[model samples]
Target: MSTIKLLVTGSTPVTVTTQKVLVARLGDEQSSHLLTFVAGGRSIIVKQTAVRTGTVVVVVSGSPGLIDAELRKAVAKAMVIRSTGR
Candidate 1:
C-alpha cells in the first residue's frame, strides 16, 4: 500500500484553517501521524494519508469560490489520467 493524498476543502476559508487545526490538535492529543501542507495563492491545503487506492477525494465545505476552484482542480487532475496514458 502507498500513501494517498486527500484534500478536503472546508465550507469557508476559516473552516479550512479550522479543520486543519482540529486535525492537528486531535493528532497531537494522540500520536504524531500524517502530514499537512499549504500551497498556492488560494491557500489550498493538502493532506496525505495511507490508502490502497489512487482515488483522491476532496470534501467541499468552504466558500463558493474556494470550493469551485478545488472542484475544478480535482476534475482537471482526474481528467489528466483519463485523457492521457498514465
Candidate 2:
C-alpha cells in the first residue's frame, strides 16, 4: 500500500524494523494496523474518520532510535490534546 491509515489507540507503539507497521495492545490482535507496512504501493485515496472520543493520531517519522523517543513524546502530547478536546 502506498498509504495506510489505521484507527488504533494512542497506546499502540510504532514499530519499524525490517517491516514497517504498528503494534496493537494485548488481545486486540486482529487490528489490521498491526499488519500495515507498505508505504510504497498497493492502494490509494483512503480516508478515515475517527467518529470516537479520545482518539488521536501521533505520527513520528525518522530513524528507529529517533522514532522511539519521538513517538513517546508525541503520544503523550496527543493524549493531552485528546483529553482537553482537540
Please give the CA lDDT of all the candidate structures. 0.36, 0.38
lDDT of 1 by residue, 2-81 (tens): 23444557533222332222222211121112232333434544432211113433233444445434544554565476
Clash number for candidate 2: 1
Q: Highest lDDT: give the candidate number.
A: 2
Once fitted onto the true fold, the runs of candidate 1 whose alpha carbons sit more than 4 angstroms away are: 1-65
Listed in order, each prediction's TM-score against the native is 0.23, 0.37
Evaluated against the true structure, the overall lDDT of model 2 is 0.38
Quote the positional error of residue 12 for candidate 1 in Å: 25
Per-residue lDDT over 1-86 for candidate 2, one digit per residue giving the tens place of the 0 to 100 score: 33334434574443322333443331212111212333334422211111122345444444444444454455666677777887
Q: Which stretches of candidate 2 lie over 4 Å from their true place?
A: 1-18, 21-54
Clashes of each: 5, 1
